[model samples]
Target: MTNNTQSLNSDIAAMAEKEFEGVYGRYRITSTDELEVQRYRLALLLCGVAFTAGLGQWLMIGPTWAWLWLLPMSIGLGLALNWIHIYLRPLHQALKLLWALGCLGAVVMAWSVGTDTMLSTVTAEPAWIWAIGPLFAALTGVGFKEFFCFGRPEAIGLTLLIPIALLGHLSGLMSGSIVMGLLGSAALLLLVLALRKFGMDAAADVGDKSVFAYLSNPQANEAL
Candidate 1:
């Protein structure tokens, strides 16, 4: 009777251990995390498509039509910024803040001068770049982060191209043709970067979950 009781207790302990492992194992990805990653990837893809579509419309159709693409581009960017898992909480929050400011700036620009004329107004008054610059700045931050983590050439190119194009136009240093070329290149590079990310393991993008856990918990840091 005693032996049977001991065996039964051991079995129960083993079962409990397995259940715990299934739920909270170090390397295990919860369904929730997986779903979040999927959304992040989808947002990235949307951004790429929006960039390509906007550029194409600007070149082939009309600038007014291209401006419409900003809606989806902004949406995708905002979603990506929200869902992105950065180890440093402060940096992540800063990026989101920048995005918010950019959106606010865009709204002000649109309200001041109707949506159809916003692009032309900004082009005519380079000083207005200040109003819309934060959006691209946030985008540049994303590119820099991607390049730093993945060493992707397209990402680095995007990081550099955006500032150069915007500043060149803002300072009246580059011709319209030159600025257009630079922006077109940036759009292509962003599209390439986004598509390549889809082929990568989602786990790579999520990075080390332990770092996120350590950063989020003040008590854990205090214990350390």
Candidate 2:
């Protein structure tokens, strides 16, 4: 190693030694590790479902009047984001299970909405029901945060979906429910597969967790 790198390595090794020895290591600047983004994804899905559940209370309040409380949920969600700095990720098997469930739900929701509102939509139930596509997509995505992995497929899929989602929603205003349902289902299923395949996989080390052993120790991932 060069003089500078050797010096830095010496320093880090010394620090690790001290911590392992129970020395005055409290003040040491150890690596600040955060949980994987997948963990936050679980919270995100809960948040989406929770926020939507508020719609029940919104129901009691009736109509556009419920917009007043939107700020509270928005702010609460903002504060929650701060916790991204600290968390422990779950195992890969769990992510796969969640992925399977999300895909199944996407298929069911699409089929149901398509069948129910096929003839006539735009009224209270259909409008809300049709919202399920994005709601499912968002919540499913929230359960599995794969922003990086989703780049190419998701970008293209969403690019293909947006105009259609908007147009379908808007068309509920003029076209029969059958047309709206058909259009909505067609676009949304595309998003479903792309997201399921890419978003569900376990990603790289999520946040900035230090890997002293992985970096310095020779056999960290030797088995894998």
Candidate 3:
């Protein structure tokens, strides 16, 4: 067995050498730069805005002021997301983990706070709301890997956040209260992905390439 293992190791090393012989550089599947870093951050920010905006308007502005604050907030979020996408067109990798985690964190917040205000016409089920966090985390993990090439921060943050968001959404949705679950759920997916991708990027661009200043009191700014 020992001899066989040694032989296998030698063969594997030889094969690896042969495979890399023609390659110019090490196959770094995780290499990234400034623009990508910002992109991840951007995704998180957008997720938070949409999540809060969607539920906040539904709950905060009574029938009389329903369209008032919500519409403006929606429009503002849209514009800000777009602006961030364009503004951080040249960033890189150090920020990759930051952005992914940030986005995940944002979605978690959205589910927690936003779901509480969903329409009561058909009351959403706790089971369904409970599922939102895991779903968001899983999908975002894929997106982070697909778009940014790294997802440790995303995976970690999402793991920690899923349960919290589940609790928040569950409290609001209740049982059969809102029939908009299907539609609302779908909307959350889009909101989470887009917001994470663009929101953090624009934010990271604040103050001449300084992520530190950009993140200072981030949650306060996000909820406001």
Candidate 4:
């Protein structure tokens, strides 16, 4: 009877140890997943800013309001860049280089459009074409960076925005602002869905920990 009891005790201890190891492994994986999810959330916020800006532009809002969009957009961009630097320290320089290039390209594109506007023969419609290159480059660059940090689904989704906007432009069904607004809206929708899933997953992790804590705590049962 004593031998049987000792063997049973050993078995239970081994089992508990194995379970703990599995849980620790899962915790590590979940932590990594949570970081990616947060990064995606930031991306979503940036998309929201873009959507607002595009909509505001479409409505021909005041320049002051248009400039205000830049503040949020800049904040989002800074957060994204900082997050990338923190999590991907090795590629920080490369990402910064890409961002600087994108910004420069956008500035040049804007300057070209302004110049076109000043020309007597240049039409407003044709001036928009100059902006397309910078837009595509920026979107593709962002998707590429995200591909490294997140996964293919997000990267593909972000990249698709460029082509979708381009198609809208080529189709002539809507103006550039409307096309941008539509793309931003679509991106925002995807971000919201992804964020909800991430949030639920994180909540589950917390719930699991709570259950584990309750099960392990002698005081918890006494209190209950």
Most accurate candidate by lDDT: 1
Question: What are the per-model C-alpha RMSD values against the true structure?
Answer: 6.5, 15.6, 16.8, 14.4
Expressed as tens digits, the lDDT of each residue in 71-114 for candidate 3 is: 33333333333333221323322233333444454455446546
Deviation in angstroms for 193 in model 3? 16
Can you give the TM-score per candidate against the true fold?
0.84, 0.29, 0.29, 0.45
lDDT of 1 at 117: 80
196 Cα displacement, candidate 1 (Å): 1.1
Ranking by lDDT: 1, 4, 3, 2
Residues 1-224 of candidate 4 have per-residue lDDT tens digits of: 99999999877655543122333233222444456547745764674556456445635643333434433544455455554323233455455555555456445644664432221111235444343334344445556665554455656666676566656666576685676565665456445433543444433322233344454567865875
lDDT of 4: 0.49
Ranking according to TM-score, highest score first: 1, 4, 3, 2
Candidate 3 least-lDDT 10 residues? 21-30
Candidate lDDT scores, in order, read 0.81, 0.40, 0.40, 0.49
Better of 2 and 4 by TM-score: 4
Which 10 consecutive residues of model 4 have the lowest summed lDDT?
Answer: 115-124
> How far is 162's C-alpha from truth in model 4 (Å)?
2.4
TM-score, candidate number 1: 0.84
Clashes of each: 0, 2, 31, 0
Q: What is the lDDT of candidate 2?
A: 0.40
Per-residue CA lDDT of model 2 for 130-184, tens digit only, reads: 3433433432333234343345454444444434544555556444444335434
